[model samples]
Every structure is written in structure tokens, then in C-alpha cells.
Target: MYATIGIIVYVLLYTLINRKQINQHSRKKWIYFSLAICAGAAMLLLSDSSVGWLTKYLNNTIGDLTSVVISE
Candidate 1:
């Protein structure tokens, strides 16, 4: 449901933004747009969990660096 709406919105926005050049390289534009959309969707799905891990990793790394600096 949400994904369908997102795809529709993306297509509409992509068409509107590319309205000027769409006719020039229609095939390439569509191929690239589809690939971008698929990649964006996959990233969106994975980002929630990935972000939490990333944040924790960053915090730990920063904490370790700060501890070393403070000790020195």
C-alpha cells in the first residue's frame, strides 16, 4: 500500500522533473530511473536497522577516541 503510493509519487515527480529531456533519451532515462527507484526502496527498507547499528558503532568509536585523547 505505502510502497505503491511511494512508487506512484516517485514516477510522477520524476516525469515532472524530466519532462524537458524525457523525449530525448526516453529509454535510458527509464532504465536509470527504475534502477534508482529500486535501489532507493531497498535502502529505505534497510535503513531503519542499519541506522541503529551505525549510530551505535559511531558512538563507540568516538567514545574510544575521546578516551584515548583524554588519557594522553
Candidate 2:
């Protein structure tokens, strides 16, 4: 649930970011800054979720692969 919400939030943030004009060399740092903020916020939103629960999303096989890759 939370994971899905987080993913949705991330996608929304991505769309919002892409619609803006932030592709200048002078604002290069803002690109990373915005992405970091979006990722952090989305992760925090999904922090209550369990890994197993999250892996049950649409991309079941891919989710399992990602879980293994991120399992530290």
C-alpha cells in the first residue's frame, strides 16, 4: 500500500519536474537536488512497508530481482 503510494508519488514528482524548465547548466545542481528530495520523500512515505509486501507489486519477477539487489 505505502510502497505503491510512494511509487505514485515519485512518478507524480517526476512528471511535475519534467514539465518545468530546469535544464540549464547554471541550474545543474538543482536537478540532483530535486531528484534527491523526491526520492527521499517517497522513501520516507514507504518506510512503513515491508520488503515482501512491496515485492508483490505488478512487476512481481522484477520486484524480486530488485529486492535481492537492494538487500544489504
Candidate 3:
């Protein structure tokens, strides 16, 4: 599907654009934590039910930090 391709392109583009930052962050646990986000996106290609699950999971996990970052 198109979404799958979009995800692949986005990941590749993002990684390419942020290669240095990613390498710099490689020593941090948060780098691996970020992969959970990609996994959640991939889940969307598998089943519709994953939408709610990932939404809740991401909101619980990353939501607060995103809000904090944005408010700054």
C-alpha cells in the first residue's frame, strides 16, 4: 500500500537527513526507544486495531514529552 511506501521513504529520508544526530544519540537509550515509534507505524500496515493500540501507547509514552517540547 501507499502508506507502507510512504513510511519507508520517510524513514529513509529522515535517517539520511539526521544521520549525524542519530549517531550522536546512538549511545543513549532514547535512540532505541525511538524505534518503538517506527514499530508502531509499521503496525498500522498490519491491522486497523493497531491504530487505537498505538495511539494509546504513544500518547502514554511520548505524548507528554512532545507537549513539553512544543510548549518550550
1-72: candidate 1 lDDT, tens digit per residue: 466567767767877787667667749667667756764665565446755787789879998899899999
lDDT of 2 by residue, 1-72 (tens): 577576767767775777455554477577768766666666555555645475567467786787889995
For 1-72, candidate 3 gives per-residue lDDT tens digits of 678667767876876787788778746457645754784576578666756887888998899889999999
Prediction 3 global C-alpha lDDT: 0.73
Off by over 4 Å in 3: 26-29, 51-72
Ranked by TM-score, top first: 3, 1, 2
Model 1 lDDT, residue 16, Cα: 72
Instruction: Please state every model's RMSD to the true fold in angstroms.
Output: 5.0, 10.9, 10.3
lDDT of each: 0.70, 0.66, 0.73
Task: Give the TM-scores of the predictions, in the order they appear.
Answer: 0.40, 0.33, 0.45
Error (Å) of candidate 2 at residue 34 is 2.2
TM-score of 1: 0.40
**Candidate 3, poorest ten consecutive residues by summed lDDT:** 26-35
In model 1, the worst 10-residue window by lDDT is 39-48
